[model samples]
Target: MPPRWPRTPDRNDPAFRRLEDFINFALHAAIYLAVNSGLWFFQLLNHPWDNLSIVSGVWLLGLVSHGCYVFILADYRRIEAAAQGNWQQELATELEEDATVTPDEAPSSPEQP
Candidate 1:
């Protein structure tokens, strides 16, 4: 199925796109906290300790974003490695197993008598 959301902006151009990404991260972080911490009931943005929203939002955003970016990179690396030769090694191992004889192998023939 197609993506439920619009395509993420390419990381190639980091000017306008990156700024938007930063803002989106901040909003998601805020909403995540609002939902999880029950702080939406309080005017979190107005309290003396309200800085938690900003701090937590940015912190969690950076942490989550960095982790997702790293995971994507790792997944890409794994795909590339498999494409290069890893799959060949796996296939060779499976074929080697097939080449082995096992006691469970079917009998070559049944006695006629």
Candidate 2:
């Protein structure tokens, strides 16, 4: 079946794209929690504590895996880190070059009339 909402045409808008990702992730996590809540409620009255523990443990694993992807595997994070590293290097080079440039090569500031 086709998607309920048509595919977005303005894929270049970074803000919209990121908000879409956030919404998608929130929906999935909400569904997971809703299901787990139901499961735990049903099992609480009759099942052993050990059985309930298993259900919670498995759900915790799912959350941790999702968090790892969002925090580490996301491409934007790597790109941001790379950009920051390059900026730091450029600042260092400029500072070093300024300190080493001889008075003859340095451009003089314009004097006020």
Which number leads on lDDT?
2
Name the regions of candidate 2 deviating beyond 4 angstroms: 1-13, 47-52, 71-73, 77-113
What candidate 1 gets wrong by more than 4 Å, as runs, is 1-13, 39-113
Could you tell me the lDDT of residue 46 within candidate 1?
58
Give all candidates' CA lDDT scores.
Answer: 0.58, 0.65
TM-score on alpha carbons, each prediction:
0.27, 0.45
Question: Superposing every Cα of model 1 onto the true structure, what RMSD results?
Answer: 13.3
For candidate 2, the per-residue lDDT at 82 reads 47
lDDT of 2 by residue, 30-108 (tens): 9878987887887777765566677777877887787676656655533443445665666677689889966676677
Summarize candidate 1's per-residue lDDT along 1-113 as a digit string, tens digits.
Answer: 84342555543333434445556766766777666476545555554555657866776777687546643432343344364567677668768989986669676897788
Worst 10 residues of 1 by lDDT: 71-80
In model 2, what are the clashing residue pairs, if there are any? none
